[model samples]
Target chain A: MFYLLDLLGTLAFAISGVLTAMNKKMDPFGVFVIAFVTAVGGGTLRDVLIGRTPVGWMLDLNYVYTIIASFILAVIFRKKLEKLRKSLFLFDTIGLGVFTLIGLEKGLDTNLHPIICIALGTMTACFGGVIRDILCNDIPVIFRKEVYATICILGGTVFFALLELNLPINIVYLLTPAVIIIARLLAVYYKLSLPSLERK
Target chain B: MFYLLDLLGTLAFAISGVLTAMNKKMDPFGVFVIAFVTAVGGGTLRDVLIGRTPVGWMLDLNYVYTIIASFILAVIFRKKLEKLRKSLFLFDTIGLGVFTLIGLEKGLDTNLHPIICIALGTMTACFGGVIRDILCNDIPVIFRKEVYATICILGGTVFFALLELNLPINIVYLLTPAVIIIARLLAVYYKLSLPSLERK
Candidate 1:
């Protein structure tokens, strides 16, 4: 079930990347690269930091193949996919929630401090988007705008608490991602965002 | 002194940044930020990888101030600095050499495998420029151009072998950067870039 959730999240992230590249008017190759990076960049960074090298993406080319497949799918159905903006958003939110939990788990496995783990979770959820934005020549969401990272952190805390309560791990996993999606969707609905850093 | 070498390198990198931003027609504020990132970026990445939080530039702010000062100086004398193209190239080569040694030292301090340390040294010397180019919407030199990264690897090996032979540490430091600069300059002079990444 966890594996399924992880795969679903990866697909969702890839979809988000393709959409972003489309908005930028990039070519098919660019869209595929953007989607691939958005799906894997954060986890790759976490893995590198923990010294679990060759990196997750390098270990399995399936993620690369999947992201490319996603790009092709998006392009094949470009207009229809564009029309389903709300549905796409839903998938992306699900991805954010699940990827955050996975990142938190990976961090704890490395015996990192809880705060750092939570931070790692947030990074995992958000950094792919950050890289996407940078590559697209847009300001990073964390630097300019969004509730994206904050939602990840809130969800990560819930994950940690659930783990501590000795709760059923399966229930915990399901609840954690659900909580994250809810938080993110609600934040987007209300346009919630962290305060900007004042220009020095 | 290490301090003087560092400042000279920083100044050189800052000048390079200014030149790049000018070519792109970036505004003054953009130029300053670009210059600052170019000068300090590699070292900061090395620090983060080695778990040195509040990285060297973050801690000193002097480095930050210096880049800003250099930026201001560049803008105030844009035409003047542009005329010193030869000196600028020499300085950039020096920066490459000095940064490579510093990266190797930091990697070794973390007790990473010697080969990894050498890789880190090359990465540290090259990544900042790659990042700068990416942000500027250019193909990175390390990825496509002359033997910039190869020079850093050669210098890092020289540094490590010197230390293994228990040569005076200061002499090793001095010799390492000197070797890097000479190698890179020679490569530049001879147009000794890597074989074409493109297939015939």
Candidate 2:
């Protein structure tokens, strides 16, 4: 189930990349590269920082296969995807929740400090979009306004808190993503955003 | 001498970051982060990709100190730096040559393919500026126009070719960076750039 959700997240991220790159009028090769980066950039960075060699995607061909499929499908259905924006958003949120949990688990496996674990979780959930925005030549939306990373940080905090309570590991995993997904839904519905720092 | 050139490269990259961030009118914190990233970003990415954990700067305090010093000096001398642009360019070119050699050596240390080593070399020499440009909300100048990475590739190829010739290892080290630096200087002097892929 966890692995399946991870693939779904990758698919969502890749589709989002395709959408963004198309808007930029990028060539097909450029679009594919963007999609690949958006799907795996964060996890690859996390793996590298943690000294996981061959990186996650290199070891698991599933991710590459998934991104390739998503790119082809998204590009073919580009016109129709407009109507599926809400579905895409839900999948992206699901990806955000799952990727954060994965990062936190990896950090705990490495016995890092909780603060560092939280940072890892947030980076896993957020940095792909950050890279995507960067490649597309825009200030990252999260840095500018979204409350996206804040939720990931809070979710990681909750994850560690649950572990402290000696809850069953399965229960901890279940509740963590639940909190993150719900928080994001509420934040977006209410149009909540972080305030940009203005120059004095 | 190699270590000294590495430090010089880090200093050059950091100062360039400071200049670019100031142009963006970022706050002090943003300036410092940019400078740090510009100094270490390429090397960090290289280390991570190669599965070298805790990274180069984490193990060596000198790199961090160099970046801090560079950031402080660059920020303080912003006005005077305009006159020092040529000197800065020289340092940056030196960084390009030295960093590419470092990356190629690391790739060889890991027993990676020569082609992959060339890629690692180019990434080490150029990705700092790539990250800098991305964060500053500009398409990477290297991807658009600069002949920067091409020189690294050619230099890396020359590095292996020299080794195959059984030249003394020290001579190979000296000549490889000399090739990269001289190529870069000539490219810039001639106003050479890569052609962009245009849409019909």
Candidate 3:
């Protein structure tokens, strides 16, 4: 079930990447590369930083296949996708929850500090979009926009707190994403955003 | 001597990062982060991909010290740095040569394919500036500009070819960077650049 969610997240992220690249008017090759990077760049960076050899996508053909499929579908349905923006956003939020959990789990396995684990989770969930925006020559939306990473950090905090309460691991896993998904939905629904910091 | 060259490269990269961030009018904290990333970003990425735990800088205080020192010096000497641009460019080129060699050596240590090793070399020598550009909201100059990565690729090819000729390891190291440095210098002197690819 968890693995399925991971794949879904990859698919959603890839489609979003394709949309961004298409907007940039990049060639097909550039679009594909952006899609691949947006889908897996975060997990790849996390794996590398934690000394996980061979990286994730290189070891698993599923990610590559999923990205390729997402690219083709997104390109073919670029027009229709406009009407499906709400659905796409939901999938992206789901991805945020799942990827953050995966990163947190990996950090725990490696015996990292909770703060570091939270940071890892945030990076895993948000960095793919950061890379995508960078490739398209834009300041990353996360650094300036909505409380996206803030939700991940909150979810991670709740995750660790649940663990401390001696809750069942299954329940912890179930509730963490629930918190993240709902919190993100609320944030977006209410038009919440972080204020920009500037020196006067 | 190699270690010293590595530090020198770190220093040069950090200074360059500082200049770029200052141009972007980033805050002091932002400037320091950019400088740090530009100094160690390539090596950190290389180390992560290769599964080197604790990373290069984490295990070595010298790198951190070098970057911090470089940041301070660059900030204080910003006005005078314009006059030292030629010297700074020389150092940056030297960094490119040394960093490429370090990455190549690491890849060989891990028994990766020659092609992958060359990629590792290029990434090590060029990716810091790429990250810097991304953070500064610009397309990576390496992806568009002169024969920067091209020089690294050529240097890596020469390195393996020399190794195949049964040359001494010391001679190989010495010649590899020499090839990269001289090639880069000549390329810049001749105003050589890669042509942009455009889809009609």
- DockQ per candidate, 2 decimals: 0.05, 0.16, 0.17
Model 3 chain B is weakest, by summed lDDT over 10 consecutive residues, at B191-200
Model 2 misplacement above 4 A: A1-43, A49-51, A56-130, A138-200
Better of 1 and 3 by TM-score: 3
Write model 1 residue lDDT over B1-200, tens digit each, in one string: 77777777888888888889889999888888778778987887667655677778978877887788888888889989858888878878888998898888877777676765776687677767767777688645554445787788889889888989999988998999999999988998888865431111
Q: Residues A1-200, candidate 2: write the lDDT tens digits.
A: 98898999999999999888777766565576579889888988888778788577755678888998998899778888889999999999999999999999989999999999999999888998888887888878889889999999999999999999999999999999989999999999999988878999
Q: Write the per-residue lDDT of candidate 2 for residues B1-200, one digit (tens) a residue.
A: 88999899999999999999999999999999999988889988888887887789999999999999998899888899999999999999999999999999988998777866887898898888878987888876665557788889899999999999999999999999999999999999999875533322
Q: Candidate 2 DockQ category?
A: incorrect
A77 Cα displacement, candidate 3 (Å): 20
| C-alpha RMSD in Å of predicted model 2 compared with the true structure | 6.7
- Candidate 2 vs 3: which has more DockQ: 3
Q: For this target, which candidate reaches the highest DockQ against the unseen true structure?
A: 3
Write one digit per residue (lDDT tens) for candidate 3, span A45-162.
Answer: 8887787886777556788889989988887788788899988898898999999998999999999999999999998888998988878898788898869999999999999999
